[model samples]
Target: MNPVSETQSQHDSAKDAFFMNIEDAYLTALKQNPVVENGRTRPQYCYYDGPLTDIVLHNFIQVPADNFSEFFSHNHLPIPELIAISHEGVVHFNEMPADIIDEIHQQRTQYKVVDYIHADSFFADPLLALNVAKQRNRIYCGHPTIDGLQICYYRGELPEHGIENLLHLELDQAIEFFVDTAYRLPTKIELPDELEDELKTSIRSGFETIVNEVKQQRRTLISQLLAQAKQVTPKFHDGEPLKIMLPSSRLTTVMQYCSRAVAKAFEKRGYQVWFYMEDGEMETNNLIKFYRNYIEFNPHVIFYVNQLNNLALNDKVTHISWWQDSMPQITEHKALRWRGNDYVFSISPVLDRHLALTGAKNIVRQHFAVDDEIFNTDGDIERQNKVVFVGSSYLNSVDLSRPEQREIVEIFIDKIDNGEIVTEAMAGEIAVRFGLPPAFVFWNLLHYAIRDYSVKWLCESTAMPVEIYGRYWEQDPDVAAHFNGELKHGTQVADVYRSARYALVSHPFEINSQRLAEAAACGCIPLVYDCRDVAEKPHWDDACLFFKTRWELLEILKTQVRPALSPTVIAERFTYTAAVDNFIKHSNIGELSQAKQSRISMFVGR
Candidate 1:
């Protein structure tokens, strides 16, 4: 082989080895410094000593053209020439076209520039790297790498430390930091008056359109509900006895007992009556049974204790909702509207008047009645000299912390002190005027404030020992001493009334409380609170005793004798039979039956 050819081959081999060593050093450096991509860490090749990319300056502070390089260099950034200054303080480089510069400036806002960077790093727009450093208080810069521009974030805020102390962030992390920082800075541009007016006009037009659509939807819903209600045609039975349905489920014990007594009263009058019972569980099955029974029986009348039930929707049949309590005590405001063949029987005349004022149909002032069999003074019992009160103590249960509740109680107490009868209707009216809950006001007035105060006065003022048989009396240590222990309703309560010589009764609304009648039935003279309404009742003076003040009550206890009214006289008037007769007369149920019979006869004749 020739010596020249061999020397040339050896030189070429040495050059290849030198290049390989340089490549190995580059690869080693890349492995030591990694970059994060889509949450995965990989080696990145950083260019430390190479031709620098041209910096596109974002002059948010509007620094002078000549001072740009010097100002950036002081902050440890590379010096680059500024080719163009945008209308919005952005500097372009690398000889960009005039049209392209205009397009960038129009699309970009000072506040939204950071958002553009976050999205595809501004499509690698080159402005992001330098602009981010200039905007932040603490600027961090690293060698431009193949992975893209590296920005370090330390606990959200950049640290004023060396490069080694800085922490490298992922793409997502960098976006979050930039977005947070960008929002913190104030916006540099303001919209023109014309543009601002246009935006407001557009928003108002859209809002009005939405409101109209919603109103149309609400009207459509109401129309559908009314149509559905009209569609329900109840099945009527011909030539059969007029059936009555008494719903006895989901009621308080007193209501349940009253329902039973009413059912018996109807049965005694030669009308078929049925009690619908439910135990609360298996509601779906019970409802199915209820509907099935209702369809088969085809009742002429459905009686409810408190508020109107769903049966009111069946306009074909008569619905009698006998309210023993106040309207607000058992139902929401919407239930006040009674349409179709619905009858509302309120115990208190005040409540009946309120119902009439609200345009409620068939509003009857019905007094509560007692079952003569259960309440009569039949059993032989020793009578005691003490005055007895039977009811719950609501003072312990009332939440007086609420301003509205406390105010209601205070008002009721004031009325009682003034010898005024504050009825459930008055309480409900007060609740509406004050924007308070009606049920809350009524309950606190009757149970908590009035009753508690009355009982306290009766027990504390009288030298004679007073007996109280109810719950929560223990809450007041003074009242607890007079508490004779709890007594079960009906037979047990009747026995106590029979044993007592005088029954101390205090009612804020009417003198027609069932308790007063029950005490009278047991031959116990009722010592009631004196009110003008009491004088209005026939033979009220013969049946019970009345006092205006605690001092008057004390004087009565010491000197007054029991009334001359007999137990039989009280029994005949306040009995369930008499109540049912009164209900039929006032509610025009007899007239309804005659009308039905006339219609049937006319159809047969035709």
Candidate 2:
């Protein structure tokens, strides 16, 4: 047989087996709750029992076997007679007993899986389910069922059920599939306006509480900053004005910590430092307002982070942009954007070379250091034996739902498996096809895949107790099981680093991450990804333990990763004080230290 015909046959056989299993499960559900004479022929709502049902509705199993006829009496909704079936007292997605499965196979009735997990199993074949759902309205609902209804609705996939307010069902658990009878009977699949209003009220109250908590945290951070500033020693300089340009208009907790540290460091160095930024705003064309602030502040030097904005730069004002991701990770467009700037700063050597090709006058290689005041283990307690990872999910930036991007990423992974790394140019071609920015496409998909795979491998392979603290990871059951908890910025993070045996640091795009430096500052041993070409910085020497593969990392973990004195000793070079000294020497800023400035200039020139 031809390859195509064989593949088709395999798929057909799989589909047939899946249908058999689902049919058996459905029949078993019916057998438990026998509908009276002709009840099978009569229209009724099928409510399959699942673990989530307990959390979603109070006594859902006790929710009148009379269907929803009396429950939704006053509403104009087509409340069908409900056939409620309890699974052999199962809570999660697991195998039912063989007798129960046999019983289900004996019964002959269409049913729906109440939980999303079961829905996935039943709707394994989208085309088959879509056709079946359309014909009989008694098949597993795929995208429009629950997960991607908003996307499907917007894409004009299923308009037959015109933008149904999913809350109308008033059940906490997602309804897996709907039979045709449910939609055909002109059912108002929406909560009544009053009930919706009540739901909104509850949601609003919860949101407000969270908002208040965040505000309190911000206020506390500000107070802590004020206290720390008083303890900072101010050194005398001829008084040069320095302005630190932030990466974002809105500062996250970590950004706020870094920004404050830099500002304080400069303040201590006798530079009249100010941060000129509008919080929570992204105004690319706000040059007028920016210039007004510059005029008021009258800053001599400006250090921008992440991206270089198109600003009117005069000889009097030194425009320096600190870029992190460089060549092979970032597109040429990013390098081009830095043109017209006075100086370009980068941590990565590849980025420095890439920016040099842009004809940038001064491309200085710098490091993203840790703030001693924020992340040091000065008063830290004894460390535990837990291996912790503190970082955000890599998948946040990528929209994996996009088929074109997903297909490209799949191909990219295959290439990686074949030992061929994807280049920016190759990623750019895929980006062009998808009408996406090449840098974003490259980093989002490739970097995301790298981190995702590495972290999963670490948690699964390591012998030590692994704990991850970050956002969006808890959404995956496999990954979530390893999650200890989330930690906010500031001392909480420092405590996490100090308390853990080793902080696992993995950055796909860069050789190093801020976490590596921060972990070191907190006297935490950093177990890093071994990529000497990327991590060519000599500063990492004697400061970190490296692993080229999962097995190597696992071996390190088994050996009991511990704090080495070198990490803490080497961490001093990455402090805010060292960072300020480096900045002054490299940029030729301030009047006090000509000898120091000359030495730094010569070092940078190398």
Candidate 3:
């Protein structure tokens, strides 16, 4: 993943950002040159002789819009029939021609809209929803067309019947195409005579000896786009020209075992990376503002972790996405709503299946490589019986539907507290109050798991009071007040993991509990629940234990388990090298950044 070498090879990379930036650069060069405005190379577009500042690329003809059906119609590209969309019970066949409606209704049995949440039902933020609705409407109906004959119509909470074709992909083939493009060096040769001969020969060589020069040009273009794009929505960067938009809520927990792995991949790949503050909210992450202010935060390419957030609604679209982590627990699970365009990347088989059912594009699956620093254990060696769970209960709302989540939280809290957790204060914290979004309305299970579950289990049984700590728990006086014997929440929280016999995870029924990995990293034997989670990965062997009932948990505690990862082992685990290496190998956006610079300076040059 040597970026230096990569830039040397792919020189045209910098030219990909937009015609807006280069238009100004080229205009400036034209102004500086003693050139005549002749027929052969007259200034096709007007430019400002002074600075060319007003010649902004953001100003284009009509506002940028998207919709395959409309695009096809405008371009006169052949397209097919679209799926019907139900809005508030009124079935609106996507742009159904006036004549096609009655004929189709008579011939085709009307499929019910199913009163499911629609793109328009997003009431709290009508404007934002409208913006997204414009895009989602395209995917909902545009792809279902097969040369104008509707094959399927989607109108429910669950995906339509047999939608497997949407996600069908030859992903490995795509990767092979790019990965197989090995390092190419520039070919130094003598000049050829005749214009046609020179043109033919130059095209043939493709810069074998000038690979670095080309890569530098590409890197520069990407950086310039980064800088200009930032100004569109400057608030996202706040101030610095370097920023990372971490659209994470509980990824900290999910990636406890996976973070260092990913971090190392990003760093080793020659990416100038920084950890940015995340709004941590699932609903209001203000992505558009980030795009507007991209110049303030000069990243070559934007990456969002997993599938929770994407840059689809940003001021300008970007090649913005990351590989999804394990979501096995989420399979066959019903979503509150499904907006295929809401995500740009997903490994969920359902995505492709839905596309096929409704006529969508193929989704490519790319995994975020594992960083050895955090995920580098040789095997599930004989560790210990101390199961340590690290997460909060607040995320259950997003994962569980209204009816099922209540049942899940109640069951989890009861197992550890013997039904003593539903106190007035606890209930207040967990209840759907203060009008939070339905998806974010779940109880703080991570905190409750620590306080109610772990505390009750230890206080009632002979197990030495299981240690519990996290960033928020350590800082809250009210939370601290509950722990009579332990030190208050603060930085001294690491000690809690050191003494634990088994880590505990009593999260709601969903896929991918991150705490399982966190506990493993800390060297406490993991005691993860037997319930399914979204991430499907290898199970814990002798290194951890799985429990389905309180009885099993107690039996295991009484007979087996103790802390295995010593403080020294945990300290030695911050190896971010692999994550960095992978980031370099996977990302070529940086090449665009280097190509635009005029000089071979030390900061970014070879």
Name the 10 consecutive residues with the lowest summed lDDT in model 2.
Answer: 147-156
Give me the candidate number with maximum TM-score: 1
Sort by TM-score, best first: what order? Answer: 1, 2, 3
Question: What TM-score does prediction 1 earn?
Answer: 0.55
lDDT of 1 by residue, 94-162 (tens): 222345334434443221212222211111222222334333322111111101122322222232333
Worst 10 residues of 1 by lDDT: 139-148
Please give, for residues 1-606, the per-residue lDDT of candidate 3 as tens digits: 111222321242111111223333343334332222322322222111122121222111111223322322322111222222334633222332535434434433222222111221211222222222222221111211211111111111222223211111122232222222211111222222344776756544543323444455545554555555634431222122222333332224433334434433554454445444333221222233343344455444455554433223343323334434433222233342223333234433434343334332344533333233333333444543343333332332233355544554565466433423233233345454533332233334333443344434533346444434432233333334333333322112223443455666654332223344344444555565554332334433344465555676776677665334332243232333533333434443344334323333443465
Model 3 / residue 273 / CA error / Å: 3.3
Q: Cα lDDT of all candidates, in order?
A: 0.58, 0.51, 0.35
Structural similarity to truth (TM-score) of each candidate: 0.55, 0.52, 0.36
Per-residue accuracy of model 2 over 1-606 as CA lDDT, tens digit each: 111232342233111111112233344334332223333322222233221111111111212323323323212222222122225643112222345334444332112222222111122122222322221121123321212121110111222432232112212211221110112111112122445677756654544454455446545644554444324322322322344443333333454456667767878876667765542221122333444455555455666665554334444455556666554424363445443425666777657666666656677767777777778878738888777888777666777788877887777666654445466677888889879887787778877765665677677754667888876677656688897666877778888888887888866435456788888888778887665544555636566887656666778888865544557765766777777677676664654245435656676699
| Clashes in predicted model 1 | 0
For model 2, the stretches where C-alpha displacement exceeds 4 angstroms are 1-248, 251-256, 279-289, 325-341, 399-441, 539-541, 561-565, 590-606
For candidate 2, list the clashing residue pairs, or say none. 27-104, 28-104, 67-82, 137-179, 137-180, 168-190, 168-191
RMSD of each candidate?
A: 28.0, 19.2, 26.7
Of models 1 and 2, which has the larger TM-score? 1
